[model samples]
Target: MPLEIAIAGGGVGGMAAAIALQNQGHNVTIFEQARAFGRIGADVNLTPNAVHALDGLGIGDRLRATAARPEFRISRTWDSGEETSRLPMSAAAEVKYGAPQLTIHRADLLAALESALLPDTLHFGARVAGVSQTEDGVTLTFADGSTGDYDLVIGADGIHSAIRHALYGADDPQFTGLVSYRGVFVRGEAPDLPNLDSFTKWWGPTSDLQIVTFPLNRGEEVFVFATTGQKDWTEEGWTLSGDIDELRDIYKDFHPEARALLDACTEVTRSALHVRAPMPRWSEGRVVLLGDAAHPMVPFMAQGACMASEDAVVLGCALEGVEAEGLPAALERFAESRIPRTTRVQEGSLANDWLKKGGNADWVYGYDAWGALKYEVV
Candidate 1:
């Protein structure tokens, strides 16, 4: 039986959930606080684990067409430029995981997801102030004193989710005491740096300064991310005006490869790192948390979005059938499975960067999301 499903937040995770549920013939709607659909981030990577989930949404080919597939994964020292770790990316990724790792602008991925949904599936400027749960379903109270009810509500509203606060109350996120500069530059404008067709990262001796570079838009542009220590992060949100001079000076003594990538960035942005404590309960009655709202991981694994994408796929699979009679149990099972799966990711991401042990990530990159979602309810 088809059900009325409501999702709070229209981010990548929310959109992914929308696509997954909509494919199930459910009436899926997204309530976004913003007036329009836009993605705010540097760029995103879809390791093979996430690529499989994208294929399930039927946008695999479209994403591939617009994204860059790094032929290899390379890591180097921050200053000396000594090659520290390497992994095969293109052919080897496909052979081992059945999907190619992809990197693309956040906007491009959002646009593709926007096109996949049905007409008017998204309701922008719908600010949800609070939620109320009844015996049958969930009711959302908007900031405008309006309310809407649905058979189920998904809190894809991201880390600062109001829905989560309404359920559990006052879960403040702690800053990780790191500030990073990020940007995207046209390939033509770059210094013709090496690893243009690869995912290359540079690390400081003590994990104090780090830089990650990769191509996007089929090598038409390069994505640059540089992390350094900053004690005071009095700002809120993911984007702040970045000082190019200050950023460039920080990595001045570093290898030319990293310097070249940083110099090409015309518009630099920075964000203070913050993360939330894992929730012991991901669901309450008809309301459930997904993505960052549930387990906002550090970017070490670059699985923040990837885990959310996996959550949607798994949630959809768990709620595959049986309708209202089975909804509660199915949701519990979904949360149960994800708590451990995503907790490991959350903890590991917090412990160190995924490449900390010289990039031996078979367990992280080689996992199959498509097969995991096919699990039968016990």
Candidate 2:
């Protein structure tokens, strides 16, 4: 029996879930608060794990055409520019993990996911005000007081998820005493950067500060992200304008190549990092949480989006062809299977020590969501 499903928050995770469920012959609608998509300029890494899942969702070709496949993942000293470690990525990733690693603009990735959806499936400007579940179905209330009923609801609404709050109660996110400044610009602006063909990170004398740079849009643009320990950052949002001068001054002692990249950046945004401890459960009745809503972590591992996509794939497998009465049990199974992996990732990201010295990455990059879910359900 095909189920009628409603998903709150039309982000990467939500749209991926819709595609997976729709493939299983379910009717899925996504309610997003934003009026329309914006070309928000930040790059996201699509490791082999994420690539394999999206490839199964049928958007692999679109991603390859628009994203850059760096030849290496490099780590260097902040001031001296001494190479500490290098990991093969481009062809090596495909050979080792069965999918290529890609770095793409956030907008481009979202567009690919959005293009895979059916028409009239997305309801923009329909902010989710509240959600409640009855014995028979789930009711989703929009900010304008309109209501819709569905067989199940997915809360992929991000870190500050209303559905999560409704199900688990009011729990606040704790600041991690770290902040990041990020900017993206055309590659030509920073043409002289060394190792332009690789994704490189310059580690500070200690672990307290770092700057990362990589190519995106098939090497036509560059994305730079710098993180440092900060004590008093209160404003919260991904779009808060950052001081370009302050950014340069903070890294003035870095390698000349890194300094040049910062000098070329015309615009930047800063956001304080925050995390919520992983919840023991992710589903309640017909309403469940996915992605950042279920487990929000720092961006150290570059797996935040990847984990969300993985969750969507696993959840879709768990619910395929199930009767309405079995929905709760299926959702519980989905949460049970996903919590262990996501919790490990959440804790690892908080430590922020992924690949700094280069170690075996197979555990993180070689995961296959489709394979994991096979035989676990049905």
**Could you estimate the TM-score for every candidate?**
0.96, 0.97
Clashes of each: 0, 0
**Clashing residue pairs in candidate 2, if any?**
none
- RMSD to truth, every model: 1.6, 1.4
Model 2 lDDT per residue over 186-284, tens place = 888877677877889888876668888888889988889998789887797788899989989988898898899889899899899989998999999
For model 1, the stretches where C-alpha displacement exceeds 4 angstroms are 357-359, 373-377
Per-residue lDDT of candidate 1, residues 1-378 (tens digit): 798989999887898889988988999999999897556776898888888887889989889889999998888887788877888988899888888899988888888888889889999999888898877888999999999989999999988899999999998998888887889888888645778889988877667688888889998888888888888879876678899989889888888877888888887888887888777788888888999999997776778878988888888888887486577788888898878878889988777666743846887787666566456557
Q: Record all residue pairs in model 1 with backbone atoms less than 3 Å apart, i.e. clashing.
A: none
| Alpha carbon lDDT of each predicted model | 0.84, 0.90
Candidate 2 local accuracy as lDDT? 0.90
